[model samples]
Target: MPKLWNETIDAHREQVREAIVNVTSTLVFEQGLRAVTMSQIAEHAGIGRATLYKYFPDVETILRTWHARQIDSHISELTQVRAGAGSPGERLDAVLASYAHIAHQTGSHDRELVKFLHPDERIVNAQNQLREIVRQLIEEGATAGELRDDVDPAELANYCLHALSGAAELTTAEAIARLVALTAAGLRPPQS
Candidate 1:
């Protein structure tokens, strides 16, 4: 096949795969994970069962792929937020606020779906990346005399992550912001 023809074929395959993923995600979200089926996804995606199987072997694979895509998008968003021009403390605040907002939104998802998605290695890797981002910011803040120097950055990063995890339970944006503020405050150096 010609180069353009090959590229077109690849693009079309990607589009079909994305459509399948979107349909599967919507069905799982609206009908519950246990209620969704591979045939349902194929019909909803407007693809035949055989075609769908060519893209994914089962419902679990599709859901895992969808979750991985979501995680990648989140990591990219956080990376951009961290890269924004600001002082170390300001950047940290922005990243934490953004992260808390994401947690708040995701908290509304079905409990079973969240539980099902939590055990994947992709989630673990994404979490590690998040921790590293926060740790670097904490180190920068400490060097700038903004955050406390009394604790290791790794320890403080763990504290920040654990404290901010509560944002997932918050019902309001105000509450999430409050949680972020409290977590950020905990990183400040003690007053003389």
Candidate 2:
């Protein structure tokens, strides 16, 4: 095929795949994970069953792909927040607040969906990525005398993550901000 033709074909394939992932996500959210079927996804996405099968072998695969995409997007956002121009403390605060906001947004997902997705390897890797991002910031903050150095940065990173997870249960932005503030406070050195 000509180069333009190949590019067009690839673009079309990407669009179709995106549609499949998005339609599957909506169906799963509306019908519950176990209740959603590949056929329903195909019909809802305006694709044929055979095309859907060609793209994804099962509903679980589609769901996993959708989740992986979400994780990538989130990690990318966190990375941007980390890289943004700021002092170590300011950057750390912004990243934690961004993460807390993410938790609040996704907190409404069904418990069943959460259970199904939590054990995947992608989740493990994403957690590790999050930890590393926070750990690096903690190290920088400690060097800058902005955070406590008595504890290991790795441990403090875990502390921040675990403490900020409370944002998930929060009902208001004010509550999430408070949770982030409290979590950030825990990283500070004791006053003389």
lDDT of 1 by residue, 87-182 (tens): 888899988988888887788888999999999999899999999999999999999999999999999988888888888898888889889999
How good is model 1 by TM-score?
0.97
Q: What would the per-residue lDDT of candidate 2 be over residues 1-192, giving only the tens digit for each residue?
A: 899999999999999999999998898889898898887988999999999999999988888899999999999999999999988888999999999998887788877988988899998999999999999999999999999999999999999998887788999999999999999998888798
Off by over 4 Å in 1: none
- Give the Cα lDDT of each candidate: 0.92, 0.92
Clashing residue pair totals per candidate (backbone < 3 A): 0, 0
Q: Model 2 — which ten-residue stretch has the worst lDDT?
A: 102-111
Off by more than 4 A, model 2: none
